[model samples]
Target chain A: MDVYLPVAEMAVSPWLMIGLGFFVGAMSGVFGVGGGFLMTPLLMLLGIPAPTAVVAGANVAAAAATTSVLGHFERRGVDLRMGLVVSIGGVVGVSVGALLFAAMKAVGADEGLVRVAYVGLLGFVGFSITREAWQALARTRRGEEPAGGRVRNDLAHRLPWKVRFPRSRLYISVIPPLAIGFCVGVLSAIMGVGGGFLLIPLLIYVLHLPPSLVVGTSTFQVLVMASTTTFLQGSANGGLDLFLSGLLIGGAVVGAQIGIVIGRRMKGEQIRMVFGLLVLLVALRLAADLVLEPALMFSASPPGAGL
Target chain B: MTGLFRIILAVLACALAWVGAPARAQNRGRSAAGIDEAVLVTSSFNGARVTIFGTAPTSPSDLDVVVLVRGPDRPAWIGERQRFFGLWLGQKRLRFDAAPTYFGVASAKPLGQVAAPDTLALYGLTPESQLAVQAGDTGMEPEERDRLMREYARLRAREGLYVADAAGVQRLPGGLFRADLQMPDTTAPGLYTAKVMVFRNGRQLDSTLMTLVVSKIGLERVLYRFARNSPALHALLGVALALGAGFVASRVLRRVSVT
Candidate 1:
């Protein structure tokens, strides 16, 4: 059924919106990311305005994270101390990122430059994670004992303000997690994403967080960041549509629950491999857009548009 | 007997004029026109046909009826993509200070056949003529502005917001005529003005102006107003709704799965 979106001022099928939310929410639950990297573009393809699509994507991600985090808590997989520390840095980082984004726009930075940068970054991250995950998977399949020891004398350990996180069994400095969160936040604000994809890798490889606690902790951070973004985009830009958000959240919450169940069944390495593939796919899609000839050369919009 | 016949014919014409007078004003000239209904935008609104029915004093063969409907104006820009480093990048936009959100016109015959280009341009009959460019913008030549204006009109036409049909108006016996202009679903809700012009042999003899309101009502109106007026409150509500729904769904789903 079609319903008119108040803020977007367009008519769209409710079922289509809900279905999109469901798919993205499932990805969020399984991967512990907000999935705005996929949702925003899909909404735009459906003819919703860019700002409205971004806000609605954030709104749905927040709901999906909330639903999955509860499941994670029940499973005793969440590291509350770590989640809180990262979220504090995330909030500050997002604010700084928004300011930086405005400054870049003022300088008339070419949009093509940003896209090229994104393609390069995603390609590097996706390739490294996939290769690492595959090697680990192959070693296990060959009946070889997995490498269990991690180097403890890294820069993360050498930082100041060391804090004991009994949940993850780490006596590491809070600075690394905060800094990692800060970077994720900056990227999320600039790209209109939840930053879960980047956060997962940082928690897994950089912080050496326990695999059991990774998904839950990442989800908690995503919930915080997504909620902040939702509020900021809605209030600052006036693009949040309650009716559209309601439809998306309605589907996302249920989908997230199912995703949590699915995540519980999969091994951590397998999940990482799947996430790596997804990231690489997104990177490829973006690269193709940059390389291909665009169908439409002329565009129309109100002045001062944003991604 | 001939003189008496002429008097009778004059009396009939005056009666027809009185009968066809518009609701807002009495017909002082040879033509009168009014829209059948004011467009009301609702949830189920797709596109609507704005039907204008009227009478012309002369015979249908001698007169052509042209109708132009223009919606509220807003600021907009059209741009062509700029290429850099062998890649298509940002747009170089030209601004239209006040452009009609919806502009459509219909006539019994082709517009060029009905009136000269100067006359059509003078009345702001085309989208190109109506689009007002912002003055005092540097580095943009007049030729570039004209190209962008044409591009803007073409884009809007593709989106069904700008429409022109030469034979959209249908003429009936005894100087009666009706024109139906299709307003797409994308039409912005605001006050719209419909102008009905009567032309004879490339000259406009009479014109009538009528206004109709396109507005949202009920839930649509309430929500649109709430979003615009209280964005902070709306944002809070959106977040709260998502959080609450998420929490409730998790709890309910857990119970269902366990059982």
Candidate 2:
């Protein structure tokens, strides 16, 4: 059956939306990351305006991340104090980024410019992640020992405003994590992402958090950031469509459950490789839009379509 | 017969003058245009079909009912992308204000053959004449603005928001005629006016204006008002809703896993 979205001003199939939600949700479960980058562009391709798609995609990611954070809590891997500190910075960054988004929409640069930037950003992240994952997988298969984390520790020690996070058992400057959170928050707002994919690498390689705490911290931040993005976009641009978000959340919740079950049996390296390929596929699709001929040359959007 | 048509046209013109002249509507029996009622836009308002039924005089085949349904106007800009330095970017953007959110024209005959050019402009059947276009005519001629506006109208038409259907109006027996105006799902909520013009022998004989209220109602109204009036609270609520869903999913997942 078709459902009419009041805010989006369009009627779309509920089944199609639900299926997409399931797919992205499952991907999130397997990768232990909120799949906003993948979902946003996918929503846009399906004819949802950038504004609605941006906010709705974040809504889905936030739901999935919240579900995963519970698992982290069970394992005693989450550092609440650190998460809150980073979240504060992330919220500030999201507010600033939302303002920029509003300005961009006001000037009507929400089409070609947004698409071009989306493609470039996703393509770079996808390529780099895929290369690293593939190399790491190959090395493990060849029975090679994993690389040491010496450089990140040295950098962490050099930074100012040192603090101790007892939960993660690390004595490092709080500046690096706070700055990272802020930057990731901005990128999440602009790119319509949950910032989990970017955060995981920084948590693992830069701040050098334990493997157990990295995913938990990433999920903590994603849940907060994605929720913030969803609210700000809705408040600023009136982009949140309850009907659309409801369908997505319904499917995503179920998909996340299935992902947790499947994740139990899979190795970490294999999951990373699979996620890398998925990200690469999304990147290729977005790039095709930029390079290929468009069927329609002209398009029009309503006032304050996004913020 | 010619003298009779001239007299009738004068009376019809006097009666049809609804704009800025209410005193002239003194006639009890005159060519009038009205719709069933206002379309109440709710949450499920995908689109609506407004049946605009009106009455005319004399022969039905000889008379043409030209209904111009238009929504409230707003600012719009259409950018033309050209390959610049190995990247496709908007080279020239046509900026214009007062572009209708929705514009649809229904007529018994093609507008080109039904009414004169000046009459169509006065009635606002064409986008170029209807909208107040503001473009940078620095290196381009004034006609460029006209063509650009036409292009803008064409784009909107392709999107199904702007429609011009000649065969849309249906004649019902006597002098009664009706036109079904399809309100697209993408149409914005506002006051829409439908100018009903009756043309005979390629000349405007009589015209009447009908208005359609496409405003949000019920849940749609409440939600729209809340979002517009209290944006911060709305946004915070959005965040809360997402987190609630997330928390629900977490609990449900654990239950299924335990079983």
Candidate 3:
């Protein structure tokens, strides 16, 4: 049955949207990452207009993260100092990213450039995580200790203004997290994603944050960024449909609760492996879309055309 | 007296002869020509005017096309005078008109001359009588279909609803029928069928029916399908998947611990 959304002026099947929310929320809960990488594409497949889908997904993510963060706080899993520092960086990154997005649109290269970048970045992340997980699994079978991956001396770590995070016991300069946050924010704006998937890994490997704090911190930033995105998209584009967001968030919140409980029971490596596989799947799908023949190549006018 | 009687008798005979000749001629014409393929076009939506288009053999001085639409229940239309009063009363009395169960449009053109741009809007059909036209599902005959189309067209025109041009209607060069229809924004989302009837010389000749579907997209539409079918099962499965990944991650990290 179809339910009519008064604000959006659309009729939608409540059941379908809730299911999508459950799936994405589960992924987010399990991986300690934003499910934007999956949710945005999934929505597009369901024939939602791109702009609305992006804004709605971000809104739902914010609500879900807010609910999930409570559990993290209860467990004392959050590193407030790290989280705050990262958020500051993220806010700057978002501004930069938003500017870049506008520039890309002005130059008419937004679609092609964003697609290429998305596929490339997702593919890299997916392969690296999957490879690490697979090797670790093989080592366990042989009764050997897993390899401890170290951060390389990269430009990201060399930046100035380094701050120490006592909870994670990392003494690195605060600039790395800030830079990472900024980069993720920019990507979020460009790709219409929360950038949690990317941020978690960067925190763990590049910034040398403990794995326990990665998910919590990422979720924290996601909550803030997504909330901001919702407001901005709503006011700027008039694309945020509160009715749609409410439905998706309702299902997502429930799903996230279940996800968090399950996440607590599982081992850290297992979460990483699963997250890797999921990211790989998404990356492969996007890559295939780019390389393969499109089913339909027509570009029609956006909805509400011709007045 | 005889001369007057003769005159009267002759006048009566002439009048009788004139009437009798036409009847015979009509019978002969039917046998010789058979039924002509007449075309009628119409478009409409609920709570709107119905636009009628068709060709007829004779242009009648007065023509009336009747259209009928049936659909989901809806609101009523307040007359213009009431609307003005409503503004001052501070009581926005939203009149509830029933869903249009039937609508129609009629014109005075003969069956042969009906062409593009010569449209008639039938405003008599009430929303209570309007019915939605389910195009593919309704197993209506050709005549019934035509009638439905006329009804839908008239209703749509009256309501100021926009409809794509009909494919079934053959538009002559530079000749087309255009009519504005108004539809209440609150019309139910569903498949609706329309019927159109054409009248010439106060007689119904041909009618047709067409179908239209309305839909919307929202969060409920996007996620509810997966959630409803297997909410608990999916939740459990997701947990299982997460657990399985966690196990793998743990083993991997333990192995990496040595390196």
| Highest-scoring model, TM-score | 1
Whichever of 1 and 3 has more TM-score, that candidate is: 1
* Each candidate structure's count of clashing pairs: 0, 0, 130
Better of 1 and 2 by DockQ: 1
Query: Which regions of candidate 2 deviate over 4 angstroms?
Result: A98-117, A149-153, A303-307, B1-29, B33-36, B116-118, B134-143
How should the candidates be ordered by DockQ, best one leading? 1, 2, 3
Q: Which of the two, 1 or 3, has more DockQ? A: 1
**What's the TM-score of every candidate structure?**
0.91, 0.87, 0.59
lDDT of 2 by residue, B67-113 (tens): 78888887776655555455555546677756887888998778889
RMSD of each predicted structure: 8.2, 7.5, 20.2
The digit string of per-residue lDDT tens for model 2 on A50-161 reads 7788889988888887777777788786887788878888888887876787789789676567678767766676676677778877888899986665354476778899
Estimate candidate 3's alpha-carbon lDDT, on a 0 to 1 scale.
Answer: 0.55
lDDT of 3 at B61: 25
Q: Model 1: what TM-score for its first chain?
A: 0.96
lDDT of 3 by residue, B1-259 (tens): 0111121101100000001111234322221111121111111111223233333222232333333333334332221111122221111111222434222222223223443222332322333124333444246565644454454444444433423332323322322222222233323444444444444443344444454434333443343333335444423332233333333433443355447
- What are the per-model DockQ values? 0.31, 0.28, 0.02
Docking level for model 2: acceptable
lDDT of 3 by residue, A1-307 (tens): 3444433333456678888887777776767666777777787676565666787788767766765676677677778888887788887887788888899888756776787788889889988888877887888889997677545456555767756677877666777777788888888888888888888888777877777887888888887777666655555555555456656765676677678878999877788888888888888887776666555422222222100
The DockQ score of candidate 1 comes to: 0.31
* TM-score of chain B taken alone, every candidate: 0.84, 0.82, 0.30
